[model samples]
Target chain A: MTYCVAIRVDAGLVLAADTRTSAAFDDIRTHTKLSTFEYPGERVFALLSAGNLGTTQNVLARIARDADTPGATASLRSAADLFEAADYLGRALVEAQQKANGAAADGVNLEATLIFAGQIGTGATGLFLVYPQGNWIAASPETPFLQSGELKYGKPILDRILRPETSLEDAARCALVSMDAAIRSNLSVGPPIDLALIRDGDLRLSHRLRLGQDSPFYVEFRETWSTELAAAVRGLPPFEWEAPRAPPAP
Target chain B: MTYCVAIRVDAGLVLAADTRTSAAFDDIRTHTKLSTFEYPGERVFALLSAGNLGTTQNVLARIARDADTPGATASLRSAADLFEAADYLGRALVEAQQKANGAAADGVNLEATLIFAGQIGTGATGLFLVYPQGNWIAASPETPFLQSGELKYGKPILDRILRPETSLEDAARCALVSMDAAIRSNLSVGPPIDLALIRDGDLRLSHRLRLGQDSPFYVEFRETWSTELAAAVRGLPPFEWEAPRAPPAP
Candidate 1:
């Protein structure tokens, strides 16, 4: 399993994914689950994927191939808006799964879920979680985010902290914290984590980072969070039966 | 479905469970999932349950009936130690499930998972997760907690905060915070939350709390956590690209 999340705040979009993939406990591998397509100042789209690795790679290849072909009618570059871009991704996902399942053994699953997040021309910045069925849902000011794969373990922080009014930096930090929860509690969702930031209207990537398990910056981030959280828990109010503290010195 | 967790620390044991139970989304009901049997100063045991409510109730009834009958030979009251108590509960659970499943239509499931936690006279205080198969595992110093049902969402905090050396109050608070995470992120695991704590040498109950969604103490606990967590996230060190700040004014 994998864990990926995309947050759409007013300032920009934050997309993140964990890189671990496994067929069995003994057969684990690291693969990038994040990909980007940018036409600097015209359109920029990031894809965060989860599920069957083969199907995800096939879908990504199709998207890239169509964008490169001159006469290809529907591609990320040709799509008028983010919704159209998501539609193309959904169709590609469905087609890839169908083709892969055709030659697979019975009971094997080849489904994939991809998240499309970026800006297109003058349209508002957006995020969409494209389903395995080729259907999708867009993030709005009210929702402001989308997630796929081993998601529940990391979701409470996102639910509590994200909002349209939140700063781009804060939203990005929230995504990392959310992923940290998943990575710590679950074995299937490991790192190096991939993170991308696309500021609204820039129509280009602002920052892209890969944080391995030993990255100093990432290690500091985790340690700081742990220390702060321990302090926070320590400061919680004492129970009713515990003796009340005297008022603070004047 | 339900969510229940039992934490065993050197200080004693902290046991908690959410009260929401449902056969379908529309068929929700409230039922206590924490049960306690104490022969004050001699022995004490608490049962935290998940899975089929009918089977759980049947097993509890059997335990009660056997304990009340003089010379029934095998009941919570008759068990020699914490492990023996767990064994009695496990056998009762299997018996209950087999009887329920035999009378039900095909495809029906009545399996339950139970955690037996307490101490017997002059022995070590203990916690055991009794399986549907009548086997069990104890919570040791290294991995000091056991959780059942919709457990993943609430697990990260437990991993971060629990230990044998953690104080009884801190461990109890950690259990509440863990329950808070599950209650916020999930529909199936919810309030009112039931909590019970037993001190290492005291055979009788230490504290028993039932926190409803609207309970003032629970509301305060949730709010405090939310506030502290938000502050903690705010205190995280900024990324490299952010402009460096000047020293604080004296």
Candidate 2:
């Protein structure tokens, strides 16, 4: 299991993902799930992956291989636009799953889901969720976010705080808060959290950070959020009967 | 689908449930999911249900019928203790599911899951989660809460705020917050919300409240929580570079 989220605000895009990967309770490892393909001042793409580690790795390796292969027609760099990129990535994901389908007789879910967000040739910025079946949906103004893997625990915050007009920094903070809640509630997700911000029209990542469990910033953020949430709970309106009760007759 | 939660704290027990029931996305009805069997100074039990509406209704009806039957040997009134009651309820649930199993041949799920909490005689107060297969698990000091139906969206809060030493009132508030989050994230769960609290040593429920969408207290609580959460988000520590960026060279 994994957790990744991407928010597309008016300012730009905020993407975050957990690094913990577990084949079983006893076998766990840390592996970064965020991948980037940057062409400096031209086009930038960020891919956040979740699901079968093998499938994601295969798809990613295929993309990297294609990019490195001279005159390859199926590389991320070859896609003309974000939509085409989503389509191309979806096809790659399906191909990876199909290539591994022969050994998936043990009922292990070989499917992988991904969030593809980036800029293409100075065109409109886009964020898409590529499904396991090779279909994709782009985020719209009304739904300015996409998430994959262990998403429910963190979704309420996103649903509440994200909007097209939200600032990039605030959206990024909200993503962290969402991820933090998921990590605390579920063991399958953990840090060194990876976060990247791509400002609208910047054609490159504005900031990319990896915060470990004890990193000062991550620690401060978690502690503050926890304290604030506890305060929020304590400050809720008291139930009518919670007021002081009269003493029984002496 | 529905959302129901029960929290057992040192002070007492807090149980809440949503009322919406849906057979399909287009067909939704409001039906109470929280049912109380209170025999003042004797035994008290609150049942919070989720899953197949028909199966739940059948099981509930059977329990009510058995309790009313003149000489039923295994009714709620006849159970020797809380464990016995849980056993009886679990069996009833399985029986209900079996009775409807034939009609459910089309793969429509007839399984029902429930959270049953209350006190019987002078024995310790208890909370049990009854599964569809007629098995149940009791809540303990380490895990003082149990939830059923659309549970994930609301779980992080409960994981953070609930403890054996939590006050009953606070637990109740937390349950409301949990339900509210679920309602916001999942359309299958909605209001009017039902709440019940049972204080230890008091065999009967201390409070039972049904809050509608327009109810003054419910509305106020929702609004206040939303406001406080927005404030909490706004108060998060600013990222270093978010302080203020210099105007870009024109």
DockQ of 2: 0.61
lDDT of 2 by residue, A1-250 (tens): 8999999988999999999999999999999999998987899999999999999999999998987888887788888888888998999999999999987778889999999999987688899999999999999999899999999999988887788998899899999999998998889999999999999888888999999999999998888887778777877888888885455356
Task: Please report, as a residue range, the 10-residue window in candidate 2 chain B with the lowest summed lDDT.
Answer: B241-250
Best by TM-score: 1
Q: How far is B58's C-alpha from truth in model 2 (Å)?
A: 3.0
After the best TM-score superposition of candidate 1, give how far the Cα of residue B71 lies from its true spot, in angstroms. 1.8
lDDT (Cα, tens digit) per residue for candidate 1, span B1-250: 7889999999999999999999989889999999999889888889998989999999988998998898997988888777778888888999999999878988877899998899988898899999999899999888899999988888888888888999888888888888888888778787899999999989999999998989888888788888888887887768899876465466
CA-lDDT, candidates in order: 0.90, 0.91
| Per-residue lDDT of model 2, residues B1-250, tens digit only | 7899999998888999999998899999999999999899999999999998899999999999999898998999888898899999999999999889977768789999989998888788999999999999999998899999899999988887888888888899999999999999899999999999999989998999998889999998888887788777877888888775354366
Task: Give one digit per residue, the lDDT tens place, for model 1 in A68-173.
Answer: 9988989998998888888889899999999998899998889999998989888989999999999999998877889999998888788778889888988988
Worst 10-residue lDDT window, candidate 1 chain B: B241-250
TM-score of 1: 0.97
Regions of model 1 farther than 4 Å from truth: A245-250, B244-250
